[model samples]
Target: MTDRAGHRKAAVWGAGGWVVGVLGVLVALPLAARDRLPDRLATHWDASGGPDSSMPFWAATFVPALIWVAMAAAVVLVQWRARKSAGGAAPGWVGATLGFGGATLLGAQASIVRANLDHTDWREAGSVTVWVVVTLAAAVAVGAAALWAGHRARVTVPPVAGPTMEIPEGQRFVWLSRTSNPWLHVTAAVTGVVAVGASAASVGGLTGAEAVLLAGPLALATVVVLCCASVQARVSEKGLDVTFGPLGWPARRWAAEDIASARVETRTAAQVGGWGYRLNGLGTTVMLRGGECLVIRTVKGKDFAVSVDDAERGAALLNSLIGQRSRG
Candidate 1:
């Protein structure tokens, strides 16, 4: 088989092996300690690090496994569709998701088991705060590793020569394009609603520690709603200008002289490390969706890209401007 086919096979097997391994570990941990565990396990903890929910021993073991299975299936389906459409190896996000999700589930399961071990009653389980923090850190590290591996595994495609526009002397040109992810918009709306609710709760009666918990989520939600919902790209004689959100106060600008080259390239969320405003091996990318991106190489040898419609024209205009600036 060709190298491409081999890579695809490896990706499939790798994902399958990861899924099975995680599932096995999730099931085995609880069963191994069944004798030492209570009839029910402390499965949920509240803000105070106290057990506020319990699940039957068997339920706790199988429920997480089931959730893992469902998530694996969804990831597999998405990768399959992407492979079929792109006719390339699995996207990097697939590995990242599997790594992150599997590690997170395994960590949470281990924490539950450890907390409930030797306890006659589920309510007597100890706080999982330390374990939770450790788990989060481990999961993030594994996810980053997996993403790097995927990037290394990717088959590099040769960059194609992009179309360039001819500019007449004394003529003016400007290009503008906007891109938005509906999913991100929905996410922002949901987070905005939560922030509003939390603000109301804080004002209504919440005080002290209770209000502090609300404050964290409220601030996080507001930031997400403001910064990650949408993006707009504009190219003019001045250079490339990118703005975030509806108000567009926060923006990035590249002056014409600072741009080394401008071109149109196709990029996917998986290629640039998933979702909005990503930094990875490919440099910084404002990825709203997978399609044509206006990519620029700065004079400082850094790369920047933004997913946008009619990227070809935008890139052409930017190139024209750069050429004119260099000649002058």
Candidate 2:
């Protein structure tokens, strides 16, 4: 409990400090160079890396800061809700977003200020291609670092006793459960539509960079749709078998002997990270939705969890099988 409290406190302070610092830098950079900047700052660049859109000097300064604040608020709200629901710290992705997004915004804001400095008009500002590339690279580095830190700081939950079923001699027992997230199905459908549209557009004469952009999203959406649609969990004498997606080609299995223990746990998306497959301090969780999950500790001391209905019974049966194997 003390460790959990400390983790929560640290997360809050780290997020708060990072938000304030990023916002401050975003707003301060433009103001500090106000005298040397143009009346209008070049805020948008065309595909050719030429300035094509401009905003007033003051707008350029506060707009990015406001955007950053809004994003930070959304992330904080997610963390707060997760804490309330599961009493766990927000997932590592939250910190990664703050780190990468904050750095990207800061870099872009600085680039705009630098590009507009000493220019009489926004149109005369130089291209920011180099700055954009560098900013993205730095953002990725920061995001990865934040993810690592979050994973390291995670507090592991202690083992808990779970329900068990009595296995009679010469009797076969098997349990099966499947869980699906409707929201994920909706997302998959939407992305699939967008991907199909992009493919059609590409075939209909959209070429060059535009087609390339469409292709990237098309491939990404297809992968998301395929992987995150649904999940199935089965437990029997063969142990636990978890298959994913409609085709179920990607699957995970654990032998009865490999399982150290089995338990039913109440988990939330915030605790395990967002929907789909997640890896955090707690362990790997196939999280389709929030609520009851079948959690098992492996002989190697690793943990794996899957959300499903009748998880208590499934866990009980798995434990029973483990006991039978030990006796045999």
Candidate 3:
């Protein structure tokens, strides 16, 4: 790498470190001013901007801070991995993703703190509807700008393993394999259960406007969790189809005609920059646990790889299918 490129990368890494530090500061800010906060902090707000749920001062203040810290830590970890990745932060979006994480989390929590801090009486609650919307919008704008900038960075495609087998033209075959990471499901389930409990607990005393506010978000979160649980991959004459368990069809499908080549590529957390639906300088990938994956290069030159068992046979069948279309 050139000296200039090395310096630029170092800058990205430094920025990532700063982001972590900033998040820590954000978490500390509310705790520092605890004396002014109400005995019960308004942790959950409804659409009408009223506090729908609250908790004792210390718990409310520290709990969200802990969760935010965890969330920040995760982003920094991913950013660190991406920086250490080949092509000098090829995932480019690392900065943007990190930015979004920091902004969204800190911004939201700051609003919550504001709502509680201004309460004139302990029993009275403050509205945070505007805060929620404004903070989220600001976070998104910052993330988008960061994302666009990250995309401008050089794109890098990792090396792929050469083909080991071929399929004959006369024979026709179908290839299908399904793989799921139990850990992913467990994580999703735990998250869903926690969300349900929290949602129920927060709105227990809420009614009408306040209840509706939390209800929409809780419902949306359940759906998102269900979608993130598992993935399924299928290859046929039509082409490759990958579908998330909850959202079947329409989300992901690549036509056979659009495919340029398919091969069994070795899988590593480093190569895809860690698992679970990843997008790096390489094309999008649905990678579960590490192993070998059938990587497909589309005619447009975009690559899509899925890490699964028995990738060799799957790759061979996909190649054969592509070749058959080429000849016919």
Candidate 3 residue lDDT tens string, 264-310: 87777687887577899877777766778888898999988887666
- How much lDDT does candidate 2 score? 0.75
Candidate 1 residue runs with Cα over 4 Å from true position:
1-164, 206-209
lDDT, residue 36, model 3: 68
How would you encode candidate 1's per-residue C-alpha lDDT over 1-328 as one tens digit per residue? Answer: 4324434444455456567767876787788778888999999999999999999998999999999999999998998898788875567798889889987888788788878887999999988898789879978987987787567456342222335477777776667666656566556545544443343333322223675577578668756654665676877678888987644647899999999998888999889989998999888999977888889999999999998777887787888788898898
Taking all chains together, each candidate's TM-score versus the true structure is: 0.49, 0.48, 0.45
Q: Judged by TM-score relative to the true structure, which candidate is superior, 1 or 2?
A: 1
lDDT of 2 by residue, 1-328 (tens): 2324433544455466667767766776677668778888899999999999999888998999899999999988887798688765566688899989987887788678767777898999988898899889989987987786566445242322244477777776667666666556556545544543343333322223685587688668756654665676878778999887644547899999999999999999998888889999999999977888999999999999998777888888888888888989
- What lDDT does each candidate get? 0.75, 0.75, 0.61
Ranking by lDDT: 1, 2, 3
Model 3 residue 54 CA deviation (Å) reads 30
How does candidate 3 fare on TM-score?
0.45
lDDT of 2 at 49: 90
Task: Quote the lDDT for 80 in model 1.
Answer: 81
**Best candidate, TM-score:** 1
